[model samples]
Target: MASPDLIEQRQYAEAVLGGLNIRPFRVDLTDGLLFVPKSRIAVVRKLCKHFDWPFKVTALTSSS
Candidate 1:
């Protein structure tokens, strides 16, 4: 389960990023994980920090 603070952060992040035409995705159902593209990481990080949300960057790997 996600904390209330985290949920609010995600809602705000979605609105801001959506307004900028950058689509964010909830990549993990179990954790309610949200992510933007690598190209937008800096902007996302900035927003997260400004909003006082914990942010981490993780690389995605494909299983061939």
Candidate 2:
């Protein structure tokens, strides 16, 4: 189960992404990390920058 704060964060993130017509990436709220699709990283980064959302992009070793 996710914590209340995490749930809230996820909802907010979803709303933000949805508003931009961009799919949301899985988030590790506890670690303050977001996993976005490689193909959409540029758009996601642009939106995050425009919205002043702090984030970092890192390559994943595996999709699963």
Best candidate, lDDT-wise?
2
After superposition, candidate 1 runs with Cα above 4 Å error: 27-33, 58-64
Candidate 2 is scored at a TM of: 0.58
Q: What is the C-alpha lDDT profile of model 2 across 1-64, one tens digit per residue?
A: 6678666756776688777766546666666566776777787777667755545543333661
Find the 10 residues in a row with the least total lDDT in model 1.
Answer: 55-64
What's the residue-level lDDT of 13 in candidate 2?
Answer: 68
RMSD for each of the candidates: 3.6, 3.6
lDDT of model 2 at residue 55? Answer: 55
In order of appearance, the predictions have TM-scores of 0.60, 0.58
Error of 1 at 10 (Å): 1.4
The Cα local distance difference test for each model comes to 0.60, 0.64
Position 33, candidate 1: lDDT:
46
